[model samples]
Target: MSNYSIPYHDIDILIPSQKFEVNFSYTSSQMPNFIDSMIMRLLRISPLSVKNIAKFLGMNQRESRIVLDQLITNNEVELQQDGLFHLTNKSMKYFTTVDSIPKVASILEHTHSLIYELTNFNYIAQKPDNNMYGIKLIATSTHAANSENIVRDRFQKQFYQLIEEDIITLKKIEGRPSIYKMGTVKKVKECTVRKSLDLHVDAQAEPQAIKVLDSIMSDELKDKTYQALGQSKKGNNIRDILNNLDGFEQLKLNQYFKDGRFLAPNALFDSINPIESKSSDGNHLFIGPCYSQSNSKIILNKIKESIAKNHQVSSIYWLAPDDVFWGKSLRFNTFINALGQIKTKQNTDLQLKCFLPMHDEQDRTSVNNYRKIIAKDQQKYFYGIKDGILDGNFELIVVKNEFAVIVLHVLDSEAEYLTSFPFGSISYDKQLVNGLVSLFEAWERPKDDGGISFGQMFKKHSQS
Candidate 1:
């Protein structure tokens, strides 16, 4: 987790794989030896005494007898009642009758470990680490695509390939090795990797989340994941985090949440900037691929322009839970200053409703963080976002009947060199503006007036 600096959430999933104990049999040959080789070759052709074997090989009977005695000890030869040395069954299998130069060959069996993904029958690097925690178990149906026969076939096909790649370290491979037998295929756990979209304020642009290595999520598993998340009680909690999200943000969620969690995708910022467009109802849309340097300057100018044109203004401003409220960007303070000045000196009838997500009502850190962002005297104008949504990454500004801007947020509090801002879209159309107002209205003032005043929240925390 320390390696990745991007503000991201992750859901651990267990990918199914099989650990195969493969028994491989191959013919092995020892280093060359003339005396032992000739003696065995002679005995293999016909039963021969020490004198006959020595005579055929042009060697002394004494030396040949010593070697044959050693061969008998090794189970390669035996002396029969007929007084002749005979090739043992083990020795018979070791040499071909037609070969003149004898080479001792023995069938040897060795067990090797191999693992493959059960979902696709592809090779995995190694066995899973059992010490790791929080990995969600995948259903058995996720691996129903590959049968045991298919897994064995894939292992057989890749066996030589693995050796060529030096993944298999068997040095002495005899001619045309094969699987003598296979151990029972057992299911084991593997983990999906975590990748994040990082913010580099000094670099050209923040890098998007990259594709994870060896994603075991197949199409079937992904469908099951989507269905699971949609039905889970915890998934309903994620819905709270998504409240008032724009269409583009919603689409990103639908595309990336295939892991059955509220995890942002690697290409979270890959969405193309829609420069301008018209709504179905004929409203003009102005969009900006906002630069991190200015921090939503285009949208701020729009807000200022709207402020200049209107005297009595009604607006709703929603801030992301963490980054904006902590003053990571100076622009937030700047916006507050400009609006505060107008309300104080210009004496405009301005009604501004602001919302922030507070994780707990009595959390001292939340109360203090809110105080750091808005002045104690101005806390009355803000409301705490309700429900169980813990964090969000977008900001909304809706000036009723004037314009609305949805700005993607920068979540890294420690990032100094902000490269690129997510995006911002503004609309001046009356219907669009009214729709945004209604959206915020429902969120801020529900049927039971679910809104909790920031002033009261802070006071209660202070007392507690």
Candidate 2:
């Protein structure tokens, strides 16, 4: 438990749950601008040497040191010793009072600014019964002269993250001394103090990078001419990360939690083909074009039953090859709107049901990131996403392609809708493609033999 600077009153400053990532980069979450997160962390655990800080960051020593120096230059942190640093007196004083400021934010303005002001006034946070947070001042210093006013001013001057990570606005109350009514959201309070998104799905998840040199040379990542993806300078480093991927059958990444907030661009994701072990039975699912968008319940139910049959189905998993969580995504407006409408507690339940590990949860996009990207608010498409990715928890295999499908193998048993092999797309391989068709042909039987889809083919195989 954290010792909050201000009196929480009835507010509970709980940490939001999320999937922890080892290295959440600026490229991933554009808000909170690494600088802001580091500064805040420094202030909370101040008076540390630059070398110590660098060592703490290890692989990020250089970047961390540079940012630390920048903080001093910016007057956010003061250099006290050879390598030691502390928050500037001004910052200390401001933060001290940040605990109890009014949190009523303008839905039209920067949400981060409101959060900053509220923190300055001595409040960690408070939300309405819906769990969609409203403003609640916890007051560290009840008499700091128009505490709310000062906080508001300071926040107006600083930078802010515009994502929906830690944010809420105040609604007026007719009779309460400080009634910050909420919208229809009820989220458990969990503030990690640090600003970043680390999504670790399973407890034993580990970090692994692959060098994608071959991929860089391929048509998937780069342009038609096959030139590197801009960062020719980043060369082999990116390649190394890609190569390591060959060892694993799947990959997962996390998004960011907004710090305050900012505006950014929308991005997209792409899926590669011939992914092995995509399904639970440790079998490979063809990678082509998945019609998952058009067919929902049918696919979901099949996957659900498939998993339940064998590998002890647990959950679902879904991932876009690449994505930008903002207005640009195909599902952005829908996802945000839905999240906004639901109560925070309900949102929490949704997170568990869907298994959105990156932060124990996810919600609407309040603003665009600096990159100008937005999430494809269509969470409906991603519901039970994790399970879908796992191949029905270890039973059947469904892959998508541009034209047709290639049913690799059906486990020992037959799944309901799954009995109809090759539901969606097929792999993009010549030899493999022909091989699959041959296998399917061999499994066919005579129509009179029973009335299965291909009885003639099955009879031929029986005779053989």
Candidate 3:
């Protein structure tokens, strides 16, 4: 049908039945057309007439004859005296080459159940004296018992047969898990594949800020005290009082009568309870007792509101006495979610600063764990201060540089509290704002030249 041809003897050794080996030197770019590929693959097992090929391909006889004629002209197929078409030795060599097996295996792996059954048939077809040259796999109309087991058994048998025939290879490479290889698979010093773990949060998952906030607020009030103190002129004096108020008497005096001003527990709660209308203007700060998940959510919502109004939320700073309460009460996950929502829109403009006394090894470990769970991009916004700078039952959150919310814990000599709710206050006075802001800024500064930076701390702890 065409002029192109190759001497028959040159590729005689490529015939499958001859059991001779030949190197395939063709690149993937030179692969034949889909129809030719299918035709060659079909003829790999046995010769097929043009009509038979047409039937197999669901094509008309004339279309198949045209393709067969082109294949014959290219020396990819041969005409037999039996009036059948089969792959020439050259075509057989190409199909049987070890380089082709991985590609074939990949295709087989992607196929559904049909390939499982086909592999099983390939196993039986390869047995000595087996006359079966083709397999027809049909899906049963109804489910049958032991169907899965039957397929699995067949798949395993076929897998072993392929391994024995050198069509597939398995190797245990150093530093890598076991895997399958094509061609002469052998152990190597280095693994070709790299393994990693991906930890992801679903974007569609709703944040639980409201729920977490409610839970924290609903908890039994451990200690309550109300304060309405005027800003002290001497910043160092106030810092001294705060740092020295761990004793029962000092704790009580500071909690109940700060600067000779006091408010009832009910009044404190009413003032501090987040109101949407009150959040509209000015810089407000909320600082209180160790925050529960609920408290974190409430604070997060307030911060969200400030951001919504296009106000600059300067800082979220906390001072905890020890890591036990800090670790137990800090709702890192809930906070991350709420902050993530804001950051997704506004970015890392807000600052998050926390100062806790890492009194022991356990405290260091707990903080380290917290560092590991925080996202890398967010670590820049979050600063952790373990150096002892500020202490006592003090919680403070400042919003928009205008107001401050303070919570003081009331504790008696017996270590029991008079009320369940903690004492809280809201201050808009310029002096009080200045004093609190000054104190917060002073504490945020590094203790000495060699003090660890937040970035260095996160990196060192995250790796550990």
Candidate 4:
């Protein structure tokens, strides 16, 4: 949510593309022709007149003449001055001399299936299994204009290559062979495909689909999306058509930020005035060195475990501030790095609200980059940052109705805040937990309500 928000409207349009099934006829070498090969074999042994060839082959001279004429046209034989026929050099090409005897090849026709999506003329691999992939089929008789010609031309261009790649296998096409000619190409059936448009707009910018988020959509897909919108009779404008679509579902940008179960305050707890309570029992409390890298890592792991696997995290509230110099403290950086793991939990609807007060101007770049890490997913990760001062350095984390962590400097001294480690405790005590929750709610309330309204602060920063 680092981008500016003038706030107009945005949407995602999922369109099921139309597909047409088509079949085409092509020619390829199948097997050898008996009569054609026999004639060539006889000529290879010795030159023979058509009469002699017809006599040896048990055919009348008329039939033999027709056969010889075809052979001559194919350049397999030639009539010489001696009035006899001889095998031409071109005739040897068809012979499979790789083995002892040369074998001749012949051609046969084949019918194969090719699918063409009407939205984009590109031939698809096969019918997609998902219904959302493509829905309606265009009738063969009434399809997009010029689609037939385009499909035919593309099939022609890819025909030979398809055979070479075994997609359209030919038994034998040894010498350079060409498609004798194209045959009937017609749509046979229909198919389905899933396509979508990610559109956004506001008061300051014109309405348009945000292409950056949709790297999977090809240029052709974009064209089809627009074409579909343009041809729709439902509405005059894109927004109108989108809204008018049947079964349309509006996706809200603030869905993740909405207060769910975690933000539902209890009247009884709200009625009780919050008071700080300290526990001495070892089992209910933990005392540790804050600057200890190992201790910080253990805490990070605890946070990860609370949100992972079977855990269903409703929300998270973290109160951590920047150092006076620039960027975050080493311990804070350790926690920031761990946020990557927390930000990307697919199974959980985790909402994290962190308050990072920027104390120095140099902290801007580092903090912004840190924000960018989770802001990419604006739905779940929420944050608030502003230049301010606090009494002391501390780190606090609370998982709604789960657990609370409070780390604070035990002694108010520069050395303790610098090189020396602070003291902290992890507690699940009900009173202590309620107190922290109260503090968080107070800080999160709206500015008009005498609170910072950290939720709106994050939302504004995200859109800004």
Candidate 5:
């Protein structure tokens, strides 16, 4: 362990004389051990001979000698040339010298006040490597008289400052039990700076969710859509038509204008630009709106690429809204068709584990089709929102241990035209994909109606 010590006299100079009125007394039983209390109290006034200590404490000389000899053996106390007993330097590190009675008294007073304010508190001594060092206050009862923040601030800034300069190092606070460790502000500052730099690098390296939105709303894509509209209908201009549409309808029309495969009035020029593909060694993610059939086809194609390369897809986890599986939805049709192709190529049934919102009237046909495609040996798990499991509207698709895609649904009108697009901000970041996989593994659900058994699925697929 690292040692941090300062002369008691230096601390004494910082304490006020008026605060000396408070008493700092300890009953014998309050000491950690009987031998410690006896030795501390005896050495506080002045060093003493073993015979003198034994006589004062009413013990035999031999018994006293044995105890004092043990203290010497443990390096807790030292014997001077005059044969007098005194505390070792190690012991002195914790307690102020007897000459600094006023400083000790002031500490006791603050401690008493803090204890009175807190209805309950706990202290956990941290290891040497821990960032925090020394006494740390975590929580106090709501009914307590003192404001927790105010009291902690005052104690940390004022009371601790006067005692020792090194004490200022212990400042990191966490929830529940308080943590204390030996650390300096310089070390903490360095750690913060390092973490900030790492985050900056991560942000720059990965494609952010916002970038997908930017691509979809680019002026170039908009201009292409406007031109396509003009060619399809004579004398119908972009401004006149856009003026009559709501924000959502305008975005939906813009997407359709780019990919004429979904709507009527086909365009001469193809506006649906493809994302630059990367090596499939690691996880890949794609994020963007998915309202059009063309976009759904793109997503389905990515999944086919993964399944085709591996021959057999070990497991598939999906989190999506109930509407995504509606019979009328292009996404539903595309997903179902893709599953059929995969099953035929592998000569085995497709296995899908889905977390979807509660079943609605529109989902009946799609859900029935889904059950028919899944393998007989492999079970299909469907988790409902009423179970209080899912947290967001974002769609997630993970293909075994290989890759995952997360597309956040755009719901509000703040993005105006962008809201009309089915989704926003897509990320194919490998780190994020792995984190989602772990999150799915750790999530809890009810025992009875959760879904097909997670254990059986894990045993079968985890090995792959």
Candidate 6:
């Protein structure tokens, strides 16, 4: 078993920081991670001052003083009082001595923050014929080992598994005693998802009922939203979705777009273009609007060019929310509607018609541009899906905002896909995840009353 220690990365989410591609001679790999960092940071700046220590340790004067007092009591350091703690002459000499335990301990503790990649060497040794040193991968007895050497061998086997999984990577090497490096600290992508799973009564008996009850309560948030842009439920009314946006404060964004035709609050998004395609028969598809629909069109185009389903979209169908003031209508505020009409009427062979699922309430501003759409005298069918729900083409999005939440689960099984932001901005580690999940539960309802389940449809489609 090797006596040397290995450092592990802190799995904390962070606002991106400037990362230095550092290649340093790591002193050692020991525990007391924060202190180890403290020493390294001290050496980098001046030879350690209380001010510097506070900055490095992220402590204020009062807390810094407390720790400084402890170091002084241990005789590990001397306090300048007016300024920082200085290493005592004896302590300095002791540490500076080449092979002191403190020196080795400090080195071992400082090696955890680097990101490294393998550059070839399997293992290293002092001389060509010396014993092979470094990590080795293999299963060892999970049975508790009585000896230190035996225990280390088991851990070595486990370490290799982690390495192979890319949880860590080898960083660098040097002479004398060989050292292995791990983890080049960088922004690891994470997603904040609001998952809604149908309650399993056997497992989630208590909480599921609590969730349903919560939904029945008139939520200030939901009520405010309903007041702004909610539509009356009819069996066949389909609303055209517009945008899902991200916001810093979800409540604020929701309130700002209370009218229901703006981006979802706290959604981080990017533009995506979907390809267009046709089925075996010349059926036209009404791809939903905004960037998601755009990506769908692009993807459909590729499908047309590929053997998977050489199809092309002959026309595009879109939605215009009640808040949308343009497109279709020429008489209501002619200028805005004119611009909207121009946008929808782009291709000669393709048509860009408006589709709004919900009926307009008695307000001129609400239906200003919708008059021209009039569903073009076509019968409106209640959508197979609802707001914040994707019927199909869930994975067709191309470009999305920088912020996105990866929902692992949703009510029933409409998707195993990514939803774009502004759905109450979520993050991987925020304490609010539980609250957000509860919110989704309150708002969730069956998309179809007697219609087939999305899961059943998905399975049927897959089998076909």
Measured against the true structure, the TM-scores of the candidates, in listed sequence, are: 0.41, 0.18, 0.35, 0.33, 0.29, 0.19
Q: What does candidate 6's lDDT look like per residue over 49-105, in tens digits? A: 777777877889678777767767756567665565676553453344333333333
Tell me the number of clashing residue pairs for each predicted model. 3, 113, 18, 10, 6, 49
Local accuracy of candidate 3 as per-residue lDDT tens digits, 203-280: 221111222113223121101000100110111223343455453231133543454333333233333454454444
- Prediction RMSDs, each to the true structure: 15.9, 28.3, 23.3, 20.2, 24.8, 26.3
Rank order (by lDDT, best first): 1, 4, 3, 5, 6, 2
Query: Candidate 3 — what's its lDDT?
Result: 0.41
Q: Is candidate 4 or candidate 5 better by lDDT?
A: 4
lDDT of 5 by residue, 383-460 (tens): 333322323344566665555654433232221121112332233455655666665655434347443223322223
Candidate 2 accuracy as TM-score: 0.18
Q: Residue 184 in candidate 3 has what lDDT?
A: 22
Score each candidate by Cα lDDT. Answer: 0.50, 0.27, 0.41, 0.48, 0.37, 0.28
Q: For model 1, how does the per-residue alpha-carbon lDDT over 1-464 read when each residue is reduced to its tens digit?
A: 22333322222234455565555565556633767777777776789887888888788988888888898898888999999999888877766654555566556766566666554566667545332212233546645444456666666678668777766666473354445455454333343321111232111234333234226435654544434323321212233334545444422333323333322223333322221333432222222222222434655565566667753465545544333212333334455545544441266546666676776555667666566455555666566765233345555667777766655433322322222123444556666667767767666554367644343455455442
Predicted candidate 3, C-alpha RMSD: 23.3
lDDT of 2 by residue, 1-464 (tens): 12211110111111122111111111111123555555455555656776767666563667777787776776767777555677776455433344322111112211122222122222223321221211112223432334444543433232122122333332232211221222221122322221111111111112112222132232322131112112111211122222322312222211100231110110011112333443332322321112222223234444434434442232222222111111222222333344334322222212211112111012112111211222333323232111122222111122211111321111112111111111122223434434433333332334454312211111122221
- Best-performing candidate as measured by lDDT: 1
TM-score of 3: 0.35
Q: List runs of model 1 lying over 4 Å from the truth.
A: 1-34, 44-49, 55-59, 79-84, 100-113, 126-139, 142-164, 171-173, 184-464
Candidate 4 lDDT (Cα, whole model)?
A: 0.48
Give the lowest summed-lDDT range of ten residues in model 6: 7-16
